[model samples]
Target chain A: MVVIARSALGKLRGKYDSLSTTEKRIAQLALNSPSTVSEMTIRELASAAGASTASISRFVKRLGYANYREFTMELAHVVVVDAQEGAKLFKELGEGDSLGVIANKVFHSSMASLEATNDALSENDIARAVLKLINAGTVNFFGLGGSSIAALDGYHKFVRTSLNVAYHPDYDIQLMQAAKLTADDCAVVISHSGKNYETIQIVKELKANHVPIIGITSYSGSPLARAATVTLLSLTDEIKYRSEGMYSLISQIAILDSLFMMTVLRSSSRTQPVLMHVRDVIERTREEP
Target chain B: MVVIARSALGKLRGKYDSLSTTEKRIAQLALNSPSTVSEMTIRELASAAGASTASISRFVKRLGYANYREFTMELAHVVVVDAQEGAKLFKELGEGDSLGVIANKVFHSSMASLEATNDALSENDIARAVLKLINAGTVNFFGLGGSSIAALDGYHKFVRTSLNVAYHPDYDIQLMQAAKLTADDCAVVISHSGKNYETIQIVKELKANHVPIIGITSYSGSPLARAATVTLLSLTDEIKYRSEGMYSLISQIAILDSLFMMTVLRSSSRTQPVLMHVRDVIERTREEP
Candidate 1:
């Protein structure tokens, strides 16, 4: 076998460095639009990517494949893999992959996400975030899509303490709620893209209103994080493995979980009453139907 | 404050034994479907639930509310709260209560789901499931939606092991693959509800193929688990929370995490190679791009 492929060997990186100039262009174009490669044949791909069929063929051979078919199959594989939060969520719908494989992928990706998040966090940053929640007059959460679910999750865990909390997917009301906040309160915003316009606008409003914000986002430079007083990042390893957005979601939730635990631990004494009261409510709900 | 009524709560053997028959019925219905109460006023609810207005007032009072208006407001509070999981997504995207109130509501609901998952686990059960995985010839993953994400996640972590791994997401294809399996393989079927039709059908195929199945579901008695060789339960607390499905999902993934750790530690030789190989692949890729 030739030695040119990398991602094909599960390396998940460059396979184009050794290519000639024309081959390099094809490789760049293909990497830039891996999705489109799935629809193109060798000849079409070469032409579209500004390379000759000979260069494309030579590139495939260099990648250590027997021929074009094997190469494109791997290309299809990479095209479907989404690495935003590092979750690989495609394959057989039901009679899916081996359980051992499934279990490993899920756990490692989540662990990677957590590690990424932790790496992105500083003790001072966490201390300050903890302080905000502990001292805040109120905490409001805003998220949408799976983020809403994550926000709700964060809310549930945090409310076990004494902090007053709020969250909504509704933009107008979330904005209004943001308006009601002051420097005395802190806002924890959840948005994977950090570019979600409504959430960015809301974060802007929160900042203008003098509310402290803790942001969780995949991208470092997004508006959501920019407006935040403190930011935590969630890392993913399998983001390029699949799509369906589960990878980043788990990462985002993990960060929220961290914030929640920190807040709960910081104020356990005062939060005991609230926690106890909530437990009572839960017990009551469970007793009957 | 007035008591919101529930139908299922009547069957519950909780603290409500002191209530009269009419009150019990109202309470049961309310517990089962609290949002239904939001549509009916105290008088209408009293008649619909087959109780007199006087008893309805008394019933609401018994549940710890001052009057009907208060009861309804709280009912509305529950109704207007955060998003629920499944097909009914974002239909009535409105701001119901204050963002803080909504936030608390969403948080509590998620905690409830996690609590439920915890309740469903047993040390002996988890140990048994882990043992099966550690010793299995191959472990197959099965799921849909968010569950699919969980399955993919499992694959990512385990691929680092020397184990033979495979995962695909198409249900029809999964059925075919299940047919190719032997009893040596273990299929880990994940469903928030054991009730999803595709999940059930896949389980059936695995059954026919004599492949041992490990089920992950919320309810122990659900068909998917009932038919499995091993079953792991992910529970949710009894809150009429939306995004409930996702809670079960988190629970499922958490259990998968436990299983993955167990497998990794148990299979020392296998674990190192998988991780090292994948890491080497990654390193090579890094050098290229």
Candidate 2:
């Protein structure tokens, strides 16, 4: 049996016809109430599904899981993802809606975006991206148009860390900056659609230089994400109508914020003194005479 | 009796000692189960409190509410704000936490900040800010350090609208830009601390120019909020530790997003054509043959 890490329920349904009549009963119980089945022990599931313990063990293995425990864990993940998706607020704003209602919709939409984006993040991806950022000669942020705001935000944040960073609002300068970066440097490219012509142009330059690119984008199959050494998605529930990348801005910044926090926490020893020095300089500059 | 638009439960507690015996019963019921009291009609509340409906009406009047419905609405607001505050994820990050745990904390903290900030926004304030933005000859964005990101974002979004928006990353340039604004212009200044030295200087310049200022800050009593013609707060639940204005960034951007949405919605007829024009320009700039 091929062990696909995709949806466990999908796998069960795909191999449903292949199961024995007794195993099909167990599969029926799991499909009917996956959440309930996830909490049931192997022995309990057997009694509930009218199958023997040995049959239940064989049923899980047939579905490509190592054991009942692994099967239950994957089912639990599906439950979580489903619950998260179920809570989506894809509400549309009406012409006569009150400001309070509009504000609620806007805030809830941003929160929903943050929730969906956060759910899709993996620890290994974050760890890999942060490692590259930490070891980079210069962390160059490449973004254009709406995404430049996120890029500038990344620069504003990472500049405070021990790492050196660079960003420019002008697209020409950003392309030039990307060309200057070598393999030792890391490029953090951000785009909502993940397929802007100029953004791809800069990504091309970074790729030619063998620069390790950390792409933050909405689409996984976009040119930027495919070319990136590490890709992080910034998902949003604002698909009903395009508000010119409104909700995506919040999700993108949040992804960067997590990266910033991780970078700081992981390298606190090296970053602490530099952070303090930066704070001291700012305090002195802002102090009253 | 003074009608305090503050917490309904707080008002009930404060006036508990002064209530008549019959009124005290209603107050006790309200304090015990505020959510239940909020849902109950006047007759139900009176019956639950073992009092007459007339006495319940009198009790609400004594509490400075005009009617039973108004009193219930205030109670509902209290319930909502409490629910929002209770949902706050103020969990601290430990050194041994995994990257996934850290990302969850970061994202939840941001969502919490957005929720708290959204709860504090008033419709009247939003209407007033949008009116100012619409009527102004130019809308200039002023923010330093952390807030400049929001200001730049505001500029980025507003530029797509019909409004002549301006923002500069450089502090000196921002100050000069502030100085150039006359009474015809409107300034939207963002500062997380609400009392930054250079931000105050820019605020002072705008004041001297007699420009109407809209302040977005954490504190209502801060210099920026005090000096502005209209003050809109961007609250955060990140008070436990000094994160160098980490969570505030998300809240501020969300606030900008809300304002942008309101502006576009309110002035869609005027902004629609310009929005389409800007989109066309962007598309052409990023298009390839």
Top candidate on TM-score is 2
Q: Judge candidate 1 at residue A277 and give its lDDT.
A: 84
Per-model DockQ: 0.01, 0.24
Candidate 1 structure quality by residue, lDDT tens digits, A55-88: 8887888766777755665555454333323643
- Native-structure RMSD, model 1: 29.1
State each model's CA lDDT, in order.
0.63, 0.83
Error of 2 at B216 (Å): 0.5
Segments of candidate 2 deviating more than 4 angstroms: A1-90, A287-289, B1-88, B285-289
Q: Give the runs in model 1 whose Cα sits over 4 Å from its true position.
A: A1-100, A287-289, B1-231, B234-249, B253-289
lDDT of 2 at B96: 76
Q: How good is the docking of model 1, by CAPRI class?
A: incorrect
Please name the candidate that would achieve the greatest lDDT relative to the true structure: 2
